[model samples]
Target: MAAQSKIPQATAKRLPLYYRFLNNLQVQGKSRVSSKELSEAVKVDSATIRRDFSYFGALGKKGYGYNVEYLLGFFRKTLDQDETTYVALIGVGNLGTAFLHYNFTKNNNTRIEMAFDADPNKVGQEIGGVPVYHIDDLEERINHVQAAILTVPGAEAQTITERLMESGITGILNFTPARITVPEEVRVHHIDLAVELQSLIYFMKHYPLEIE
Candidate 1:
């Protein structure tokens, strides 16, 4: 079956984890993998892995397993690793600075090409090879990139996102607290690190589960 046919939001989010694990398997010279092995690596239940893989159609036999190289190729094609996604940064604060330095270039497909900030001191500066421009140049600078990472203050997220959409940005990785809205064609992925860490701590405190 076509991968898109089983594109649930939750399952879509898990694709990265699957891809990472599969990549590791390939590097380790693993020829095949099982749902239980994937579950253990990603910390998800085996049944969940099986169900998730089902969307892509029978990936394994009842007793055998999935060919690691086959799954790697499938996910690479699904995630569109063939094309590079240029991303812009909307803020140059601490977290944003960190993102610029360790930008997702290790993945090879995603990269930060430019940055925008309102601070005069930060403008005209280069962070981790990406040049920063004044927010006033947002529309103009962002027009050169297809995606963005928004780490501006909470109050500025919506306004920045609106400008991003107007500038033709097709995807966003939002780190601010605000849930900015965009047209159907644009995709937004919010990463509230604080909230996620808090949730993880809460689970560890109250609902610890065995690794197995």
Candidate 2:
């Protein structure tokens, strides 16, 4: 835990991307890979990749580069891939329904254990193998779930977030436009698709990125 805490947040965020690419390399029967190779595959610069790997001392050799299987095993342990993380969905709208149909556990060890909705028609119905319950049961049924996906309307985001925090939610992936407040210790990742799309378009028009 102490070691993990010391890693830079930016590097920590990139670890999974590196792990995924390494996993693909192993699947393709590739044994050794250079940082330059990884840079191209994952779209990260070679120098940045070297620096990120430096956080964990001696991950690769000076001349021999990296061993695909060895690096894969190392990242599996570092990312706690052995254990599956349970999550709860707090809405049953269009976006939330699509998320249910997607099998996240196929790539990462994260699964939506259940979903909650205010609509009586959605409640008691199962979508994508995940059971949907009434929103009133949030506290009673959310026990043991570590994280949540907040897909409710912007109006209900704060209310649902308060309820989720009360039930011991550690983190939230908030999809609502409203910025819900949370305690200092609680982590929240806000992903507004509209805002992201606009930002992407603006960057492309104003600052064109060079193609590799």
Candidate 3:
């Protein structure tokens, strides 16, 4: 088996999806599951599932399949389900407000512990039980939180990103249209809603699926 660091990033990205489905099976009193069954449930081909599991050694038997409880325990450890990771939200506008109101407690280890915004009216308020602080106080109040959600306007995204990196934030979920720059150690995931919607429409139009 390969070390965790050696696992392909594409395979690692699908780990959470596999974990969630296995969790559901366990709750339904399923004691074991076959690779084919897992493929159907997760929509990944059985061959790809087999290859993904191979990276972590023999997870499932040839005929007996995989033990639900054992697989769940493995995934819990791999995904760090026992420990809680606190995060900060860096905007409080409509999009950011929706994130704060979102319930992230279900099967997730990360929590939004605090928020930041430049608006004086929104400062010192608590939305979804998470406290909001002035953006100027970011470095002072961020504490041990290492990840942040960037929902600030496009113009402010890059400036706030640099500040966040300097203030010890290593990972960012950037929801803004701006393409922020960061050092090699810093990781940023951009989620552009408009572009994604446009891509979906384009794919449906050009690569239409055949019906049975």
Q: What is the C-alpha lDDT of each candidate?
A: 0.85, 0.90, 0.90
Better of 1 and 3 by lDDT: 3
Candidate 2 accuracy as lDDT: 0.90
- Estimate the TM-score for candidate 1: 0.86
Q: After superposition, how far is residue 196 of candidate 2 from its true place, in Å?
A: 0.2
Candidate 3 lDDT over residue span 1-212, tens digit each? 22457889898889889988998999899999999999999999999998988876647888988888887887777777778888999999999999999988766688999999999999999999999999999999998997999999999999999899889899999999999899999999999998999999999999999999
lDDT of 3 at 187: 92
Top-TM-score candidate index: 2
- TM-score list, all predictions: 0.86, 0.95, 0.94
The regions of model 1 sitting more than 4 angstroms off are 201-212
**Candidate 1 lDDT over residue span 1-212, tens digit each:** 25655578788778888988888888889989888888888999998888778776646876778878777777777787767778899899999999999948665488898888999999999999999999998776666688889999999998888888888989998999889889999999899999999999999999988898
Flag clash pairs in model 1.
Answer: none
State the lDDT at 118 in candidate 1.
Answer: 94
lDDT of residue 2 for candidate 3: 28
Model 2 bad stretches (over 4 Å): none
- Model 2 clash tally? 0
**Residue 25 lDDT (model 3):** 95
